[model samples]
Target: MPTHNDPDTFTFFPVLIGDIGGTNARFAILLDAYAEPKEFPILATADFATIDEAIQSGVLDKTSLQPRSAILAVAGPIKGDEIHLTNCDWVIQPKGMIRDLGFEHVEVINDFEAQGLAAASLEPEYLEKVGPGETHPSLSRVVVGPGTGLGVSGLVHARHTWFPVPGEGGHIDIGPRTARDYELFPLYEPIEGRISAEQVLCGRGMMNIYHAVSKANGTEPVAANPAEVTALWSQGRDSAAVETIELFATYLGRVAGDLALIFMARGGVFLAGGIAQKILPALRQPHFRAAFEDKAPHSELLGTIPTFVITHPLAALSGLAAYARTPIRFGVATEGRRWKA
Candidate 1:
């Protein structure tokens, strides 16, 4: 163990959190619960050989930062103690981890679930509007993010209380809205056999959409990576890139709209993940809202729901911290009480 940093090093007490995704695990310390998260340090998970190596070495020193609670926003489906990180190379046992980390409270939640919690604590400056309407703070909020993979979760506010509902809604077969989108279905079969919404809405999915469209349209795509495409789209370099971003935004809107309908999250929608931040300009187009409100007849309903993108980079850490300290009351593990999620 590394020796703890001198007490004088930190002027305030911050809760330590790790946002572990399929590609990146963001480690941060939060001084203020969710309002403002000071980015202490960011580490590329690939830099370390193992997840534990990176976190234990960077956050757990005998001295500098003291976090009594910890929450891990993980990418995979959170069942029980054994967590399988979808985009990562590891599965974790919470009991073992909590014990080894020496944390009095430790909780693991799906990345989307954490994102939902993070959404509740966002500051006004940390958000960018993707569509045309303002969010109604009193209504339920939906959280969607696209990174190495697409993650979805919701928060319903009733009488001023926010309740988080986490699900594997991302894995369902995607409902393609257009003929060109129909061709995109088979393209994902080789990987998932059954394409989930994320197959076309996330990081790699952006490439999939680009390549699929390129092949379908018989036009050579100019961009090399999704980032390049997003950059070019933002700069108005390639119309095709613009088209790709449109498709991405459209599909994302479809998914969000669907989730909103499912959860009846009439309050608002929260868009997160590292991807949305990069594609903000692209999402401002007319196509974004068109897809969002394309709901049958009830299109007027979507118009009322507000959508906001999470601009805070470390926003999800708050959710992880909250998860660690809150106990599950039933079904999945309530031997004396219950278990689930």
Candidate 2:
């Protein structure tokens, strides 16, 4: 097997790009550098036992396209050969994939890293600005997504190349600020002993907040799941449900803002995931932006940094496609992540 030490010298054609999350695995084929990605139907991770099984049944069997290289963005940290997704049951072994699926090369990356790549490369039409600010080209940017789990990554422009920095930012600590927050926050269940950002900022996190809000209000929790809670909020029937989503947006803004400060994301802070796209009106409200700009010493700097929601459905694939097409434009570190046969 040949290791890819220099990203600039790396080359792969007929690439199979995937955005594998906890729930769904989306795949696409880039036949060549100039060809647009040909996407396959979204596959539920539960339907197939392994990543290769899903790809074979959902993608390879359906099309005549044969890809030589695979680029997968998974929802867990890329460490060693065997990759177990954080929330899903799928375990991705790149070398095993090369051995079983006949691929020449394989690259595995964190799911949010793909989101960061999308944020750096997506067009204006695919992004909806949440507040008033402008994007400073070539500056560092952050992408935060609240979904099955909270995903966070940073995109930095250095040495005339855009580099996506992947980390477990979702596991960062989060706390309450306001009086109402103080009352409700105590009710939230802690993972281990303390609450991380993912504890109150994801799909199950919405339920956590809902139950907490219900307890604080001394009301019975009516919503069964995150979707029902969002539905109740949308129908304007349940006050607790409303508070749940509101708190969710507020906390999301706070986290996004914190990441912005960490990276000094002057390029902009982009929000991805289904929740952000669903709660557009709530995110547009003053509360979200207010919490985001609450950074006291640098509130002015926060205000100048923009926040946006990624609207495109196949965003992660787009990012992989961009990197596949023009590898020189991105300085992706593939020293340990890339495998070959």
Candidate 3:
């Protein structure tokens, strides 16, 4: 990678930010400070093999303003300085890469964390409203996305600002409501003794549901793979694929409702990621909504809160940038660290 000179003048061009998920990595060249920065041009992961190659590509070359800062939203756990990408072969470091990428400051946050940050600043247009009523500004907002894996996070509203919490909620044991889930272990038991929400809510989760339903129906269950299943569904040729997606959405909605119950996320619930976008058209279907509001006695409480699908292509990138601007306190985790005014 080649190093470039930074422009001397101080103007707010969009900070070069990125969000790298299991499947793809997206980068931006902007001319503003926020996630909603003006004049953004996006580039795909397939366009370049290495992140550095992608950053220094023709897009950044056209900008006379050299990016002095950056933030990357990467999926998987960040243990110390090194990041071992779960879905990809890339390994990244925050402090070291800053110098390498010609950035004065850089941050590589958890992908879910980036989503949490983006969730805080989401506008009405970026979301597709599912359930009725308005978001309760006082309630905690749950953000869950079923993509490469089932990612979960929450934004707690305290006095003023939204505090983002990043955790391994996906690894938590799923509330297996149906007989199929109870019997799911025999297939995935080789990997672990029991399955988590991620096992049945992610991309592979779709396959797991398809096969389980196949066995339940007393027939040979066939859907080529995740991609093939999605493709078939796209063309409206596979009922199994459709059923699998429906089950996935239902379970996902149930999980969201449960999270809301836990966090009292009356603020709202957001379905994010590429997978949600693909299934947004189907989410309007009956079964999906039924499973979501299937809560016991207090089911009506969920009806009061709103549910939405985040449709923005670079929603996570916006979050990664927003989080980057937050101040880091010397001690304890508390509010007043991030300012958006």
Candidate that would win on TM-score: 2
Worst ten in a row by lDDT for model 3: 329-338
* Residue 19 local lDDT, model 3: 77
67 Cα displacement, candidate 1 (Å): 3.3
Best by lDDT: 2
lDDT of each: 0.69, 0.91, 0.69
TM-score of each: 0.83, 0.97, 0.81
**Model 1 lDDT per residue over 245-293, tens place:** 8988998888888888887776678888778888887677777778888
Per-residue lDDT tens digits for candidate 3, residues 1-341, read 11111222122334666777777777765545444443345555656666677677744676776776665677777676667777776776655556566676554556877787777776778989885758876668888998888888888876556667767787777656777556644554223676788888888887887777666666676676777777777787767777777778888877888887887888888898888888887788766667777788878887787888999888887665554444221011322111111
Scored against the true structure, residue 215 in model 3 reaches a CA lDDT of 68
Please provide, for model 2 over 12-130, each residue's C-alpha lDDT reduced to its tens digit, 9 standing for 90 to 100.
78999999999999999999999999999999999999999998899999988888999999999888999999999999999998998878989988899899889978999999999
Candidate 2 colliding pairs = none
Clashes of each: 18, 0, 5
Q: How many backbone clashes can be found in candidate 3?
A: 5
RMSD to the hidden true structure, all candidates? 6.8, 1.8, 6.2
